[model samples]
Target: MARIYTPAQFGGYAAIVSCAAVIASVSSLRLDSAIPVVPADDVSAISRLALILPVIVAPLALGAVALLPEEINQLKSSFADGAWLAIAIVAIMQGVTAVTNSLCTRRGDFVLAAFVKVVQPAAFAGIAWLLVRDLSVALATSWIVALLVGTRAFRGLGLVSGWRDSIDACRRAWRYPVFFAPVSLLDTLTQALPLLAIVSIFGTAGGGNYSQVQRLIGAPLMLVGLAVGQVFLKHAGDLIRASTPLTPLFLRVFRNLVILACLTVVVIVFVGDWALAVFLGHGWRTDTMFLILVILPVVFRTIVSPMSSVFLLYGRIGLVALWQVSYFVVTALAVFLGRSGASLDYLLATLVCSEFMMYLTYFLLAYFLVRRVDRYQLGLK
Candidate 1:
């Protein structure tokens, strides 16, 4: 076997990222969420922020890349050089992480996978520091690094064979994600709109406060969700690829999520307030509000994220898009109506209600997809 990536290597990387994130978080002074407010404040900053959306859309907008039939090969050549250069310059740490995780998954090296998970936060911490100074660079760099690293690591672990293999794997992976991009964009808009709305209706401080609440609480929830999704993706991908039954697997994942949701509810009910108070101080410790507005959506979203892997396995991209569209519409309308009251409580309540409804829709859709897969696998249809 090629030299294994020791846990220490993973731990070291994680530490660096963690440190960076800590610095970034502090530097942000809880202003990361205030980003959405930029366009509303200064026209120049708004233009800068607007420019980023296209950049964000570029990589995933491969369909546009494909449309240049006469220049297909040229586009590929150009994109190859540009993408690699961008990733190298901006996302080296994240790239390392992605590659490592892919390798671990392919090798069935759960130990390495576990290690990779821990290291990512350390990298994030590092990226976080950069973010404090420049939000755009930090955001772009973090994602590029993470994706490239995952891509490269998959090759190292023999999940993929080489650069071309890695590209193909990403292409396949991107298929479903890309299909859902429109609705995904909508969801992004809805999720991010609150901060924007607050800034428009209120100001930077208002946007910043709500944004901070989302970030502080959202971070841990996302981390746990990340670990869960990664583990599930690896396992489920292997099973589906092997042609093993997936209904049982789907049900199992659902059960675990339900358990997690229950536990989350308990925590939110009890220690959530104390934890928030300790971490964010009294002004930010609206855990009750956060629990209602943020935590539930996070939990619901986490549950769907893993299960979405199954849809990818089945190539049900359109269905996934449909679900996200539903979610976006609901969330947007809720936010819009909530803003009318001009109170934080009203906004928080709207967010919570929208997410709860969205989660129900996600669950139902997920159930339908799984059932369809079962019939297809059984030759019942």
Candidate 2:
């Protein structure tokens, strides 16, 4: 799909998709994280809380966009047509999917959770192949349909229970979303804001290249991180509930991730350019320097990914949220400093620095949190 489409077209699609993702993330209120931490009895309620927000917020957001069509157009000229409608649909779908995925995770039904993860990109690739001529619509429609299908799969699992339980559940878990929603929003913004800035300053083509590089380097690391993180979250939550000492578990996971990160860095440093040329094709090929620049941040992310669950496990959402805000601020500042031209070197450098800072902060925070947990368990405090 990336190869078939020009950078401008791909960039436009990427911008809209990023915007929809930001909206969805905000509407979700981070209840997905809460699902695993909250009591099993409150799972139904949290799921309901997840559903209610999107239902209420998506429409209001769509209404705002509809009313301020000119403002939206100014923000992204690609959204000049009825593209905003597609964005709205995607946002709503994403919100619903987040809730459903969380419910599946809480229920320990990783099969369903994993299926939901696979369905979106698989559907997008298939749909994009068929609609090769119109990449924007293809991408939007793919997400809309995939998310809807994934959400529907949870129906048979009895996630909602009933209208009465839905209301009661929301009441019980109200605090989780209220506290975590802003944290989730800031985290989502940390990701989306940089892409949005790149698109705004460098146009869709620059955004396209940026998005592609992220897809190439970030995707592999994210896949491994997500799988490990999910298992870590589930296991850690179980241990906490069982009153088990988490110091050993935390140390084991940390050591394993460090080993994995070392191996990943070595592989990318040696063969990254060849791998990129072979997999992404000659058109996507770049000099080894650029490839190195791209992989550096991904390396940081690789190390940070496994430890991300620690923040959620230890009730340090505020610290994580503050770090996300700092990330966005630094990224935006870097973009402003380099806005003179759309230099890939400049953008990559900025991104690499920002990602390193954010990941490093996370590592330090996780270390302190783990030490605190260890001390408490040993009666040192």
Candidate 3:
């Protein structure tokens, strides 16, 4: 898009997408998180709840987006025509996609999940190129991902029917909306924070640059981490069912992620500028220090975000939510400190340190949660 649209336009697209994403996080009422923990026998009910809630709740989430200040819709108006409508549609579509993606992963359909991860983005880019003057990145990507994944996300979900199943589904997983909804909401907001912060503090051009890095670098790594997480969530259930020790499994996953994390940090620190120059071209600023400060936290995030599911697996949703709230506050504090008569690099630096610590706090919590669950399951407690 750099070759076709200005940085400001790309940033506008990102802003709208990020706004919708926060709503999308809870559009399913976070029922999808129940998939991994719910018994295989009750999988149908859980899937039903996960899928159906989005339909009922998506409009509400979109309504929340629709209430966003009118100023948001004014961005790049000629290119981003119908920006508010785009947010509403993307919010609903992405919510459905998130639910279905989890459903597919529950079925061990990682291939399709991985395929959608890659292909949906590719499709969006292609669609955007064709619709360049229209600036369709946000809308195009949401449509493509929803269409590609919803087909299989609904597989085997037709087993039950009628209002009976719907009510039964609600009865079965009422804990999700009550418990994990806030966690998902806080998490998506935290994930979207830096981009929104950049846009707000540093302006649209900075947001554009940051979103590109995320799309090209941070998101792919996170998706791979999430793919691994899906497998972890699935297998974590099996180990629990069989009364197996989770510590060994947890450690093995942690070690592997550390290796991947190290490799990514090294690549970004050494050749980040060169890579950005090649991929995004010289038109965009690709400062080395800025990249390090902004991206370092993402490297640590890749290691922990996927594996943090241990808390949920152990029925510690409340604990995880508490941690997420703390994480968001400290991160926002970092941004606030950085913005108060401090340079952008400083904002990113303090943000990095604070977030790195928060991620460590989460990783340690997950580690101990596994040990506790293992002891209880194996009768060591």
Candidate 2 lands at a TM-score of 0.88
Q: Model 1 segments beyond 4 Å from truth?
A: 1-117, 123-180, 379-381
lDDT of 1 by residue, 244-271 (tens): 7777877888788778777877877788
Tell me how far the alpha carbon of residue 26 in candidate 1 is from the true structure, in angstroms, after superposition. 28
- What lDDT does each candidate get? 0.51, 0.72, 0.75
lDDT of 2 by residue, 1-381 (tens): 656777777777778888788778867666656767776676666666677678678767667755775545455465547567777878888888877767666667778777777887777778777755665566667767667766654554354456576567666666556767776777676677767877877777777767777776777777777777777788888887776777788778778877877787677778877876776664554567776676677777766767677777777777777877787788777667766555767877877787888788888888788788878877989
Give TM-scores for every candidate, taking all chains together and pairing residue i with residue i: 0.62, 0.88, 0.91
Order of quality (TM-score): 3, 2, 1
What number of clashing residue pairs does each candidate have, in the order they appear? 21, 1, 0
Ten-residue segment with the worst summed lDDT in candidate 3?
A: 73-82
Error of 2 at 5 (Å): 1.2
The collision pairs in model 2 are 45-169
**Model 1 TM-score (2 dp):** 0.62
For this target, which candidate reaches the highest lDDT against the unseen true structure? Answer: 3
